[model samples]
Target: MDNLSRRDFLKASGFIAAAFALWRCTPREVTASVQPAPTPAPTLATPLSADDATTLTRTLRRITFGPLPNEVARARAIGLEAFILEQLNPESIPEPDILAPFDFETLEMNAGELLRVDPPGRPIGELMGATLARAVFSPRQLYEKMVVFWSDHFNIYIRKGIERALKPVDDRLVIRPHALGRFHDLLSASAHSPAMLYYLDNASSTKEKPNENYARELLELHTLGVDGGYTHQDIVEVARALTGWSITRPRRFFGGGGEFVFRPRLHDTGPKTILGQSFPAGQGVEDGEQLLDLLSHHPSTARFISTKLVRRFVADEPPEDLVTRATQTFQETDGDIAEVMRTILTSDELRASLGGKLKRPFEYLVSALRQTQAEIEPNRALFRYLTMMGQPLFHWPTPDGYPDVAAAWMGTGSLLARWNFALALAFNTIPGVRVDWDVLAGEASAPEGALDTLSDRFLGAPLPEEARSLILDFLNTLDAGFVLPALGALLLASPYFQYH
Candidate 1:
């Protein structure tokens, strides 16, 4: 794609774009009364200037899944303002050649048939492994993070037939490219994709026996948040609007297929009203397109999407003021995702909310990988750990995607599972990944040094004096080999580690 200047880009678009630019012109003033939240201790924060350190930590934790060692160093070197500008606009960074390891052509291979076979070759399980490996190992950090975000936004369950086969292509084409683009365009693209149609049961939704499943989710889960103002009747009308949008069978049992086809014969040709807006309606694919456009601009869509972004990058309950600003950005930019992110990241409210949110399983896994500098090979072992950790790839049973709250992951079985994984990971018991416990401990005969070094290595700086003493006391009784795993387990299960 040719590079289009933001100035020119804004001018070509309509009034919505103008409103967004105007909103951006307004400056926010920080107040004295608001006490800034503590940063995620040690790892994500390094006690620099309080003001700059707070901004840097929130951006680091929010934008990428924790920072790579090089990235953190680079951010510190370049300073916070420059880092935020670069991340919010990574198109300026040339697309890195990191995807050469995977067979892109093969990923595009017969997407429908693979889902039909029992024990699918690259079920969501395998895909999740690939995703984690790439995100951790690839230099293309921005693309990977956007893919993760888009995947959650337009979630699809791989358990559905044919969808398991189709997800690889869905990731590469339907989601990734549009991850940072206009929401209207992305919504339209997803609505037409076979993976989405089949996954959500829209492929089977027909005129005579119209199914409301995909339609309801498209509005409720994918676009407008549940609380976004819309009635059940809106979902029905949207479903009717989406009638006849389906894909054709692949030629020769899943070798290759034609473009998605709109079978007007199967379409519900009736007048429909959605979100208080009426469509005279027809028997064509325009119904789906119109609905996507409408939802893309709805006030509820802006608030829903912005709030979700806040939850993901900030705290579970992000400040209403931050959400309001981000939502305003969304509405103004006509849902330009990068701009919405910029609004959130640059805000004082976001900087104030760091360390208050719990890390979801994926973030926890990635952050641990970065912290330990673990090497991933064979990849399935890492995949298995994610499953055991309760956040398997693409395998969410419902299309709503994985839950982000701490309650979902802090259960007894989950915590125990995390402890076992942490032990294995630190001790190099998990296949294809190894951590150097000896080096991690070095020549420290005393538990204090070992615990302190491990704390600094994993958590960024040394632990607090009390935490250090507690870990050393716990470690003093264990054998040398047992010392590393015991300390690792405690660190992984710490309330501190859980938040960031």
Candidate 2:
């Protein structure tokens, strides 16, 4: 069993090619007639059926990294509406001390303190580790998912100079605190972040020479969509309004740097117009604050943010009606993130979107770790696999962050990397990560029984009879000792596991 090669494993699971073909050609039922719940409650509007149960499981998969068995039972017990409410208010959920195993000093440090760490890159590494740890182990699953979403939405590359030191602060103060709060507050916090200012060269912007990097992204990526009505002059004026939003530079020892500071001397101090609104002259920091307020509450921002949320939770191409409704929720609630998410999550669109979205590399890795109940130490060894899969946390060089579409991730190299990871994890070859195969297998000792059990555990449903027959036939060829790991790896790498 220990000596089994990957080639042998693949050969045994020869039905993979056919499974993939069926997955591509088969049409899914992506239309449901369910109505949105007006509010979160403990009751359902209708009786739950097998299809409804499957839809709830798929919905859980969409919101969380992946649903553990206990989570699935809890959702079934309380119903999806109540579950959504509980997740929306994450303060109600008591989180396990998942970070106790990792001794990362940087999680608590301010940017000024982070700059002085002995090894320069240690802080970034610890940040990535803690992020993965939370995704895999946190009880507040939906809150963590929003953290990932907003992290991508307001991305700052960690490799940039001094940003390596500043981003941990941004992740702590700017992103996490307001991830589920109001959009205006989150936008304002990001506008004032030292990490963002440094990453986008806003710290060096001045009245004489304003940098448009942050301003351009603020319009195109952050708030307004690319097609959102804005001319080149709008970006220029926004940049001018944001001038003098800089980070402090320590002059003497312990003077303290890496804090956001407004410098009136560097500000434009003149009138500016943006998006058809004018700012009167002589305003200092209020200009940027006003700009954030305008952008966050803009109708375009509502539509743009709503589209991205639907794409994340519903489908690659978002449903138009859901987007419109979510936009209305955003505007009506004054950009309340939790209410907007409620609108999206409780909608029939999400239920109809079952198996419609593909899991990105990071989601795939985390889901695997979760489904297997893998004990992890959260270190570089695990991150190495993510790098191989092309989604190393905080490593995207561009401000747009990682791609969210299936086409961007369904390449040969990416799929191969996923297969290799499945093999490594099932064989217990990854350092600082281990899966107890016997416990995962439960009472199913025979190969046929083990296949059904593991399929339900991993995919939330049993495999089709033909596919099950093919896998069991292959398992018959393997030695008794090699059956469980091979079966587990085959299921993980299967096409069914590729989507939520």
Best by lDDT: 2
Clashing pairs in 2: none
Q: Residue-wise lDDT of candidate 2 within 124-189, one digit each (tens)?
A: 999999999999999899999999999999999999888877899899999999989999999999
Clash statistics: count for each candidate:
1, 0
> lDDT of all the models against the reference?
0.68, 0.83
Give the lowest summed-lDDT range of ten residues in model 2. Answer: 40-49
Among these predicted structures, which one has the highest TM-score?
Answer: 2
Candidate 1 shows a clash count of 1
Per-residue CA lDDT of model 1 for 13-113, tens digit only, reads 32223222322332232222223233311122222124554446545755666676677778899986677778766676565554465433344455554
lDDT of 1 at 204: 80
TM-score of each: 0.83, 0.92
Residue 28 local lDDT, model 2: 40
Candidate 2 wrong stretches, greater than 4 Å: 1-50, 250-255
